[model samples]
Target: MALPTLISAAQLHEILEQNDLVILDSRFYLTDLQKGRQQYELGHIPGALFVDLHHQLAGDETEQTGRHPLPEPSELADTLMNLGIDSQTQVVVYDDMGGAMAARAWWMLVQQGIEVFVLDGGFPTWQRAGYAIEAGCNQATVAEQRLTISYPWLVSEDDVVANLETERFQLLDARAADRFQGENETMDPVAGHIPGAVNRPFMQNLNEHGLMKAPSLLLEEWTSLLQDIEKPIVYYCGSGVTACHNVLAMNYAGLEAKHVYVGSWSQWAKRILRKIDEANA
Candidate 1:
């Protein structure tokens, strides 16, 4: 049987002893790049390798790219191979922040057609459940086989602009309502969202306990928002990290969006600003 997209702490505990599984501790802090590794060194799930959000999950950011651009396919494949992930490996990723960062890892693996799961409720739930923790890193024996990258998951900035002009697809922003509305201008230099995008914060996907809502509940929430909209939805967040959380939730609800704007708001805002500068000149 294949593992579901989301797995509970109990389910994870049962499979911890399994050799073919690859567990990733994806804890990250946007403000402090070193925080995730610090936390991992302090304590993490046993037999889990640390996957840095910046170092492994994201590629280099250019003037036109988002803060967390998708890593190069070859780079990511090498990283996965270093982690001993081959075609047969089952990966489970978790973080301290309600699977927000962890979902990025999950989405990347799934895009490559690898079977992966986000630990529901993340590391906190595991700690709460009295599961054992191991300090320092537990590196995997590097695998000789390379994983293939299908590269079909993300939509580019050009695709988003075309969609906006054509109005052929619905645009969903996974940032907070304030950020979506151009109120909080903390992360990105620009304050506003895509011209016609709708706001649905990724955090809403979780319940009071920080665990993902039931699939039925997720379906209800997403269905209400997308009721009158068309298929082939496009989703984005500030830097394309939290947006994956929304994508994961939608997949859990059996609703698949067509594309994820890998550059997201950061790239969009930059392009918009450049246009403004050119017009002013």
Candidate 2:
């Protein structure tokens, strides 16, 4: 299936009518913890379920795994069943900031082998387009949660280390240039990125208003970044969350769907020998 990383507002409006479609609102702010829930409480897309960054999207690995760590598959499967998602459902996810946070949930579902898509521009763009909003939460009864757990798409730390020797896949870092360069080390003690990750800030996927830029532009930028490689791409961020945004953008730009480094910087920080910052002074 040709899964477009983004679906237009008008297109989403049409998709909403499908009974088997599941919409997840992933609107979140890194600085403001309460704002995303507040926005969801105030109004959200009709029949959309909310996935909070701190609560549902990740597990309790704040100290070890940056901010968000991959949730246990059984636990995540339960959450999905509660949200009315099954293997057959077409899931749509969105957030306020381009798709940084939303892409986390998108990648999570994809890792679980679920076919999911991201709302290209996210909630703000939906609002800007004058889309109708509705209040109140939606709940569906679940008889039992049955998940066909699939986790083969991800690459392991050993895989990353081995790939570093051969450039098997392009390591894309979806973090700010400052963070990628090890200039700022506040988030994690050890600065610098994985051995050969090229920086591609998640924000580059969006416009000033938090909507995705044109596909042609995205293709051009990613093309420049991947010029030296002839392998599948892999992405990582502070945790595993924001990197999914870059994956979504690359997918939209007609790039291959890449692997996500779920443990990301947090895990890498724990092992200092793995810290290679030659790219930065």
Candidate 3:
């Protein structure tokens, strides 16, 4: 059987030279956009290409759309191709921040039905294992491939708005507890979350060391969380970025996470702020 999409450091190191494998370094910081690239330039896993969250994985932000609006599937497919990913390629992505940022890349690819592996415990684990590291920019040979998008797994802002009245899906917030409670309002100017969304901070999926918890433990936690809720689960975060971490966690725990509010709290907050401004105007 094939390895799951969350591969460990040793597993990745063992298959580094496989012809069909492609490794990506996706380290990023929410406050400092350029920091990730600076770290990658210093050192990265051998043969790993760097991918920026905003520039590559996401599209330009508008006043209405969230901070990290997703790129079109075709655009992402082009990005993968440009990075030397072919149809037969096995892709693995990692970041220093555990799987938080890397999961964004995984979601974008997985939405298009492409299976992507996130480096379990991410770059820190690799470093701890004393794997080979290379510095500076590594050139990626362009690949001639047009990827097919056979699966779409997102709910639009309109859908979310409609759900408020219908209560068709369960809203799960992936922000920190304080942010969810309208207290630690740091990232976004608007405080609090969507009216009915429940809090499940993305970090809950990880242990004290910032590594993802075991699958069985995750299974227990997720099962208990979703125990009485019969509605389909929908995940969201400040900018629809870290929310993917929850999606990855749920899937890692063998739960089917088929929906994401791509625009997430960013878009929702933007909309609400616009309304408040209009009223004040």
Candidate 4:
């Protein structure tokens, strides 16, 4: 049987010595991009390679694009090959932020039809378990074969707008409740959400101890929110990062939604604000 979408630290420890396993340290901060690498150099899981969220997971940003846009499929495939990832590799990704950033890599890889899992409880859990840690970078030799990405899992901004107009799908925002309610405006110029999006903060997927909730529990929570709505559900976050966390959780709970808004709230808000500015000008 294949491994589930989420892997425990114990399961990872058991397979840590396996040659086919590839662990990635995805520790990242939205405000401080270098903090993740700095922390990785201080200490990380043994044999784990560091993946910078900004450089590797995201693409160049512009006023029209979200803060952390999805990288070009071809570019990301090349990067994965350079990192020694191949078709047969079993990839495990983790971050300090309760799988927020790590889930992005997991989602991207899974979208490419690659088998990958997010480390449940993240790096803090491994530390709590007294697992061995390594310092400095561990670069893998570039692999000869490159991976291909087929983004059947992603939804474009146009899809979001159509969903809003047609109500053909449910739109879920994974941002914090306050942010969703437009209470605290910091990340983007606009305060509110994409008009009809329901706020289901991604952090709610985790327990108070920061580990993911049981699949049964998650199923109940999500099912209730979804209710009788039979349309395909779409999820988004500030810049499409944490939204993957919700997608991972839903998949673990057996309620997988393949459509994710890659540009998310940041791009949506920007476009709305720009249109308003243009209209006034």
Highest-lDDT candidate: 1
lDDT of 3 at 18: 91
**Tens digits of per-residue lDDT for model 4 on 242-272?**
9999989988888766678989989998899
Per-residue lDDT of candidate 2, residues 1-281 (tens digit): 54546777889998788977888998887678788888997999888888787777787774435467766777777788887888777889988777788888887787666778888678877888899999877775452546755556566567776887887887888889998999977878778999877888988888876777787999999899788777788888888888888878877887777688877876778655334443343
Order the numbered candidates by lDDT, best leading. Answer: 1, 4, 3, 2
Candidate 4 segments whose C-alpha is farther than 4 A from its true place? 1-3
RMSD of each: 1.6, 3.9, 1.8, 1.5
Instruction: List per-prediction Cα lDDT, in the order shown.
Output: 0.89, 0.78, 0.86, 0.88
Clashes of each: 0, 0, 0, 0
Candidate 2 stretches greater than 4 Å from native: 62-66, 111-113, 143-145, 164-167, 273-281
Better of 1 and 3 by lDDT: 1
| CA lDDT, candidate 1, residue 140 | 90
Q: Mind sharing the TM-score for model 4?
A: 0.97
Tell me the spans in candidate 1 whose CA falls farther than 4 Å from its real position: 1-3
Candidate 2 TM-score versus the reference: 0.87
